[model samples]
Every structure is written in C-alpha cells, then in structure tokens.
Target chain A: MKRFTAICLFLLSVVALATPAFALRISIVPDHGNPASPQMGDRLRFHTAIQNDGNAAQEGVLAWISLVETDSGKEQPVDLEDWSAHKAVVSAALLPGQTVESIWPMRLIKAGSYRVVVSAMSRSGETLTASPFVDFTVRQKPVVESSRIVPVALSAPLLIAGLLIWRLRENRARA
Target chain B: MNAVAVIARKEAGDLLRSPRGLSWLLAMAAALSAFSLLLISDAELSLLDNAEAVYGMCAVIMGLGALLAIVMGVDTVAGEKERGSLVPLLIAPVARDRILFGKLAGIAMVWAAMYLLALPYLWAAGGAGQNLAEGLVSLALLGTPVVLGFGFLAMGMGARLGSTRSALMVCLVILLLAASPVILGPSLRQTAVGRIFDWINPLSVALNALDAVIIDSQAVVSQWLHWNLTLLFSGITLWFARDGFYRTAL
Candidate 1:
C-alpha cells in the first residue's frame, strides 16, 4: 500500500508539470488582392488568427492593432487616423483546440510603407504579438492637366509687366 | 564673491531691460500655460485615461523651458559681443570663470522665476488630484539638470561663435537634440540607428526621467544616473566655454 501511494504521488507531480497553465499563438495573414500600399485614401484588409494551445479554455483575449513604419531599421508608429483606418478591440474566449479569426479593415491615407502589428492579451496576462510589414509606393496626382498651359498662365502677366516697364524706361530716356 | 554677485545683478538688469528677454519669458509662460490647459482638459475627458496626458504636458513644458534657456544664453555672450558691450566687460578685473558663472546664474534665475509663475496654472490643471506633490518635487529636482545643461550649451556656443545668428543656429541644433525623442521615438524602437540615437541623445534621457517621475513616482536615486550624465556634459561644456572665452579677443 505504501509503495503504491508513493508511485501515485510521483506520477501526479509529473502530470502537473506536463500540463500547461496557459498558451497562445498569434499570426497575421496579408491579402495580396488588397495589398497594403503607401497611397493616400487607399483601403486594404488583413486577417488575424488567435489560437489556444493549452489544454484548457482561455478567457479575456483583448486585441489591438497598429501600423508601424520601418525605416532605417527603425519602427515608427503611423497614425491610424492619418491612414484612414480604424483600430478595433475584440474579446473572446478560446477553448482548447479552437481558434478565432479577426478581419481588420485598414485604409491608407498618408503615403508610406508600414508594418501592421497585432497584439493579443489573455486575462491571465499571457500576451502574443505578430507583425507583417508591407512595402509599396504611391504616385502623386497633378492638380491640373496639361503642362503647356502652365507657362502661358505664368508668363502672360510677367510679359505684360515687362513690356510696360520697358516702354516707361524708353519714354523717360527720350524725354 | 561680490564680483560674481555684481555680474549677476548686471546680467539680470540687462535681461529685464531687453525687449527680447521679456518676450522670451512671456513665450515660455505662454507655452507652459497652453500645455497645462491641454493636460487638464484632456484629463477631464475620461477618468480611465492613464498618466499619458500628464507626461505629454510635462514634456512640452520642459522642452519649451529648455528652448527659452537657450534663447537667453545665446544673447548672454554672443549678442553682447555683437553689440560691442562685451569688450568693456572683458577688460575688467573679473575672472572669466566668474563671468560665465554669473551668466549661468542669471539665466537659471529667470527660468526658475518663469517656472514658478507657471506652477499655479499647472496645479490648477491636471496636476491637482494626481501626485501633485511628487510631481512638483520631481519638477524641481530634475528640472535643474536639464536647464543647466541647455544653459551651458547655449553659453558655450554663444561665446565660441560670437554672433547671435550663429548662436541661434546652435540653439536650434540643441532644440533638435532635445526634441529628437518625440520625433524619433516610434521609429527607434525597431531600428539599430534609432537605438544608437536613443542612447546618445540628452533629450531622450530627459524625457525618460520625466516619465519615470510622473508615471511611476520613481525616487531620485532611480534618476541619479541620468542626472550625473547631464551634469558631466554641462561641466565639460562650461569648461569649453571658459577656454573659448580666454582664447577669443572679446
């Protein structure tokens, strides 16, 4: 009886150590169809996946998303408002062997390359972060068409003013 | 010594009499007031908001205050020389070190006076309900090193350049240095270049120290390392200013 009890206790300790208290996995899926570009007033979509890797259900998963600019090896936080994208937070309970997906709608208002970082935190204080930075260029649009019209618009007044000044100078010299 | 006192009094008198000096002071006051009001109004918006608003307010106030110090210092030496008044003072028996110390003392006094005048408004703003005493203590303690550092930098540049325009440019450089963290904080967190910038920049240190005080209520010992670094920088700059003054014809 004593030997059996000691064996049971040892097995229980191993089982306790093997069971994870809490585990989480996070990932960002970028969509090529709605590729993120550095164009003002452009919209894009991405998907985020969260999974519970532990044996038990995890509660209070709060998520946040931010766009970061990667430049000169630096990660700069791009203002979501300037990008015309709204940041949203969602909470859900994830049971073991279950996963949750969040669809993020992002708009690019200011032209720049950026990385989207999504973070999720559990009520028990476990946190996971994933970032997918996309790079693209934006072309500037002209205010008005036809460069030929620009010179005429700019030089007409100058030509008239120059002529008037020259005529005055000549009249003064003749006087 | 009475010589230092006399120089201090003279510098203070000149600062008060100059229109630029008064304008600088008013500008500092205005900046502080605007920041304080923004903090209070922001805080009143949501009770759930953290100490971010307070930190922002304190940072702006300290930044503007540092700028004002630079302005005052640029005029302290370079402007005087440009106007041809520095020659007569240079001829006097007063030690060059004393003159420099006197200038620093006068500028510090003006900064402190402006800071004190702005304190009430700060208190009435967001600082009233949340760790007001601690904030004031931190302000008084940490503010000293920052103001001293900028003052030394400004005076050194002014003495070396001997032209207010050049001095102003130097002041702008220092302002850029001080404001780098705000401009670069986001990008630096992920890049090697930003990491190096963060380590070398005095403005970054100042802002971090202020954050600790306002947010964590960390003790002065926690900030001693940064304060020591700033003091060392100020000492080196002051030494350089003295050496430059000795070499210059004034």
Candidate 2:
C-alpha cells in the first residue's frame, strides 16, 4: 500500500507539470514593426507577429489592423469621408510554440498624425488574444508644402515694390 | 496716343484719391503680410521645392485678382453715372473708344500694382532663380487676361445698366456663377455639369491653367483655347460698352 501511494503521488505530480505545457496560449510579440514616420503618398506597411506560446496549436487565427486619424481642433474622429483601407488577415494554423508574421499595406493619401491598432484574434468568434497601439506620422506632400510657403515669399517684396511704384507714379502725376 | 494716355493718366491720378482703391491696396497688403509672417515662422516651408510653393501661391492671389476685378470695374462707368460724374468724363473732347481704353489703362495700373505687390511674396515663397521667375511670369501673364475679361465685363454691364446698384447685383450674380467650381468639392466638381461649367468659367480656366503649368508642369500652349474664349469675351464686352454708353441717357 505504501509503495502504491508513493507511485500515485508521483503520477499526479507528473501530470500537473505536463498539463500546463500542453495548454493553449496565444500572444502578440512586439519584435519588428513599422517605421516611425512615413512620407506622403507612400504605401505604408505595418508588420505584426502572432506567437503561440503554449504547447498546443491554434488553427484559423485572425489579425485586424486599423488607422485612426486625429486632426487639429477636433475631439471626435473625422469622418473617413474617403479613406477605406482597413482590413483583416486570417491564418490557416498556428502550430505549438510558433509565430506567424504579416505585412499590412496601406496607401497614405492625406497627411496627418495617426494611430495604428493591431489586434490578434481567433477566427471562430472574433475573440481577441492581444491588442497593441502604434503611433504614426505622415509628412505633408511636396505640392502641399510648396503651396503654403511660395506665395508669401513672392508676395512680400511685391507688396513693397507696388507701394514704391504707386508713390513714384503719383509723384510724376504731381510734377 | 495722346488722348488715351492723357485720359488714362487722369484716371490713374483720380484713383490715387479714391478711397476704394486705397482701401483695396491696404487689404491686399495686409493679407500678403499675414501670409509672409506665417511662412517666416515655420521651418517646414524651407523644406519644400520652389516650384511647388509658387504654384500654390499663384492660385490664391489669382482668386483675389478676380475679386479685385469685380470691385474695381463694377464702378468704372455705372457707379460714376449713378453718382452723377460721367458727364464730365464723357463731355471731354476725346473719342468714346479712346475714353474707354483710357479707363481700361487706369484699371491696368491697379492690376500692375496688385501684381507688383505679389512679386515680393512670390520671391519669398519660391526662393531665388528660374523657379521664382517661372511662377512670376506665369502669374503676371495670366493676370492680364483675368483683369481684361472681368474688367471689360463689369464696365460693359455697368454702362448698359447705367446704375451702380443694378450693375453690382448683376456682376455679383455672374461672379458667383463663375466661382461655382471652386466653391464645390472635387468629387462634385468632377460631375458632367460641373465639368461643363468649369470649362466655361474664365476664372476657372485660368486657375486650371495655372495649376497645370505651375503644379503639373504642363505646356502653356495647351491653355490657348481658354485664352481664346477669354479674349473673345473681352472684345465682345468692349463693343457692348461703346454701343451701350452712347445709347444710355447720360
């Protein structure tokens, strides 16, 4: 009986230790991601890695990416109005102790500050495993930058020249 | 030459004393100054290419030019008649066509002043060299046609109407029509009707040409059709003025 009891205790300990190793686990690892700033009109990309830390495998996983813009003097998200680049990627399977990375491509049509939201989810019920927020900046387009500065540069001197010419013409008229 | 120049000189001299003309100059200067302050305050503008900046500024000032055309020309003949000052200008020993052209010359000075006022800002915005000159010349070149188109229209309408209030109302209505494309969104403006209207509006055409040249780097020759329409309208309006003025009960 004593030997049998000791054998039973050893079996329970082994099962307890092995059960956790075989349990299902999913996590998002922030290894390599998108760059900090993207130029205007560039097709920006975000990289995501979904890792299965558990010994058991997960099948048919999903990843969602979204861009939220914040402009000046506005608390609410401005109507997308025309931007329609949000998308989701589904994987066939995530093996035990494995990671799957994806590249999400988006075109930058407008310049502004944005936040990228990445979500790792289950394909069956849209259950989220991990959610991460990344900050992003899109610089102004070349045309836009020029538009803002050129007029002022050219106009200021022209203003002075106009005044002088007017004065000169007025003096000549007086003479 | 003497009659037109003398009349133009006299009209130009009178404009110096005109409160409206001086006020317009003040307003334009203030706007340019405000924009200059903004540009000088930022490091971001320095990073832009010279050509890009010139194209943008050209679009804005040209719009303002359209406004100036209305305000200045709206009163050239009609308002003077309304205020009982045309008899002196008309009774003078000069041909009616010379008088009309002379008055146009006076307004041309105003256009020159506006363009001169714009040059410094362009230089400041565009930086030095061929890039700035390209923008300056384009704006200057387009400026003449814009002034002539709207200026002649206003003068002809004023002479025909013989009342400042009536002429102003009509001119504003037409101005609004011409400005429709600019007032609407890109998607809306691209619709079939909007496209036709934009093609018809001289201001829209000149602005479009400016964008094509300064922004898209297209050839100026491609804009000849719009220029042709613009010149034709200017000529027709001048004819209307000559016939209409003599017929009016002044």
Q: What is the alpha-carbon lDDT of model 2 when measured against the actual structure?
A: 0.66
TM-score of model number 2? 0.64
Worst 10 residues of 1 chain B by lDDT: B40-49
**Which residue pairs collide, candidate 1?**
A40-A109, A73-B191, A75-B187
Report the number of backbone clashes for model 1.
Answer: 3
**Residue-wise C-alpha lDDT for candidate 1, range B17-57, written one tens digit per residue:** 44445555555555554554443233222221224445665
lDDT of 1 at B141: 65
- What TM-score quantifies how close candidate 1 is to the native fold? 0.56
Off by over 4 Å in 2: A1-175, B16-19, B34-52, B128-131
Query: Which candidate number has the best DockQ?
Result: 2
The models' CA-based lDDT, in order, is: 0.64, 0.66
Q: What is the lDDT of residue B121 in candidate 2?
A: 69
- Candidate 1: regions farther than 4 A off: A1-175, B16-19, B40-50
